[model samples]
Target: MTNIEKKVIDVTGLSSDQIAMLEEIVAALKAVSQTNNYQGKVSLDRLEETPQPSLTLEQRRAFLQLTLEERRRLLAQQAENMVEHYQENTEWQEFLAGGIIEY
Candidate 1:
């Protein structure tokens, strides 16, 4: 295989569809980085210094009104939904089969 073809298949065990999607996402990120003149360094310290929208007191109060159990249940449901969504992708099933380690 040519180097281009070899690079495309570097991600072992993924379906062709998954590889195509991955390539598209990678291309998009590369385009964004080039257009924005980004050096590709990911630093959360810079992000922390960026101004973020603040929640109003009422909005904060409403968000905090959920009981701990209610919050946990909501979080669990969201997690389940995300897992199900990923599970529908054959590539994700292969990833899960290999197991994932979270940092």
Candidate 2:
């Protein structure tokens, strides 16, 4: 028999339906992988283009002197900034309005 026929005979145990189902699964996995790869590439490009902040040693020291409440407030503000940076819907607005974030 031909090489193609030989290969097909080797897996003759799998019905035609099984082969088709396997192909469908493989195609779906490939599509998902391609999408994930594209997203990862875009994320990497964005990260590379984003500027890194530089802080002086004195500024870092002063930041460390903040009280726990002050630190929480600063962190919440930073979270808000990140949300705005990504243009994400604000889910923390209610929490902020509730005054759960101490200043």
Candidate 3:
């Protein structure tokens, strides 16, 4: 069998929670992946339209001001989920590599 097929066959035993976490990671990865090849300026107008929780002005501003480093650290937490998912379902390795999920 091909390497990816072999990997998928190997990952059939994942727990439900593990699968869910992998899905979440995949979503986050997709969101950040655009940065890898960005060539145009990003606008904040869309962000301004999105409704957030009932934070005070200061709290909202603070959250908006988070540094890229801080965002990366937060995003890295998704890796923990990815690892757990992989351990539970070895076949997920293929999913990760295929962009079906995140690595």
lDDT of each: 0.45, 0.44, 0.43
| Candidate 1 least-lDDT 10 residues | 1-10
Q: Which tens-of-lDDT digit does each residue in 1-103 have in candidate 2?
A: 0011111213367677555554453354345434433221224445443233444454445455544665566567555545554454333454466765669
Which number leads on lDDT? 1
* Candidate topping TM-score: 2
Q: What TM-score would you give candidate 2 relative to the actual structure?
A: 0.36
lDDT of 3 by residue, 1-103 (tens): 0011111212367677545554454454444443323212223566222222243454434434444664466446546545554465444455566754558
Measured against the true structure, the TM-scores of the candidates, in listed sequence, are 0.30, 0.36, 0.27
Error of 1 at 39 (Å): 31
Please identify model 1 stretches exceeding 4 Å from their true place: 1-61, 91-103
TM-score of 3: 0.27
Candidate 1 residue-wise lDDT at 48: 31
- At residue 3, candidate 1 shows an lDDT of 12
Worst window of 10 by summed lDDT in candidate 2: 1-10
Query: Which pairs of residues collide in candidate 2?
Result: none
